[model samples]
Target: VVKYGKWLVAAGAVGMNVLAARDHNRAEDVFGALEARCSDDPRLCDLGDGGAYLDPGTEALYQQSVGYDRRARRWLIGGETALLGAAAMFVWELTRKTHRPDNIPFEPEVRSLRNATGVGLRLSF
Candidate 1:
């Protein structure tokens, strides 16, 4: 089985990185504020370093808002677990060659019970 492949990874990355939804933006504004404060005289920017910056470079507040979302998405697919599963698949062999290598092989015990004829749907949060 091809588990936790491209579809899961891309969906997770795109949704979390862009964060184009309205509700998430509103929540960010409620919890976080823009660095728009120019404390010294309204003409100078308060760089949060106790020093007044004459012309602080412009940076979008939305950039900061997406930082944690990116982390959350990268971890959504359980990458480490998938890595371990792949390692285990390549590490073990279920069918040993007792007869000629070209002889018909029986299905592995685990797969015989775990799989079915109909389509199977998988979903996770």
Candidate 2:
């Protein structure tokens, strides 16, 4: 169970990294497009008129992707944390020592010698 939890956490981290990288690339693509359209001076684009420098569709996609990335990151962190906690608990449970009831009966042995009999109790760890 602990091993599985570790794998789960690792997978989530990898997924989050991939998502972040993809979102960054998408955002960069939009910026590049805007820069090209504005002759490398995106700041000079019609800003006061509330004009969208980038294509409306692409901008919406970038915005949605960023929002999804943030949500995914938060969820991944939560999932990883939960999985690690569960792994710790599993390891602790497996390694912890517990007291058991002493239920073994003691056996006595009697041996007869040439002229005497001896009695002894047998015990084991």
TM-scores for the candidates: 0.26, 0.42
lDDT at 105 for candidate 2?
70
lDDT comparing candidate 2 with the true structure: 0.62
Clashes of each: 0, 0
What digit string (tens of lDDT, one per residue) describes model 2 on residues 1-125?
55476566556656665665665566566656655656755454544355543455445544665565666566556656655766676677679786865875777799999999999998866
TM-score of 2: 0.42
What C-alpha lDDT values do all the predictions have?
A: 0.45, 0.62
Q: Highest TM-score: which candidate? A: 2
Q: Model 2: which residue pairs collide?
A: none
Candidate 2 ranges with C-alpha deviation above 4 Å: 40-44, 49-125
Clashing pairs in 1: none
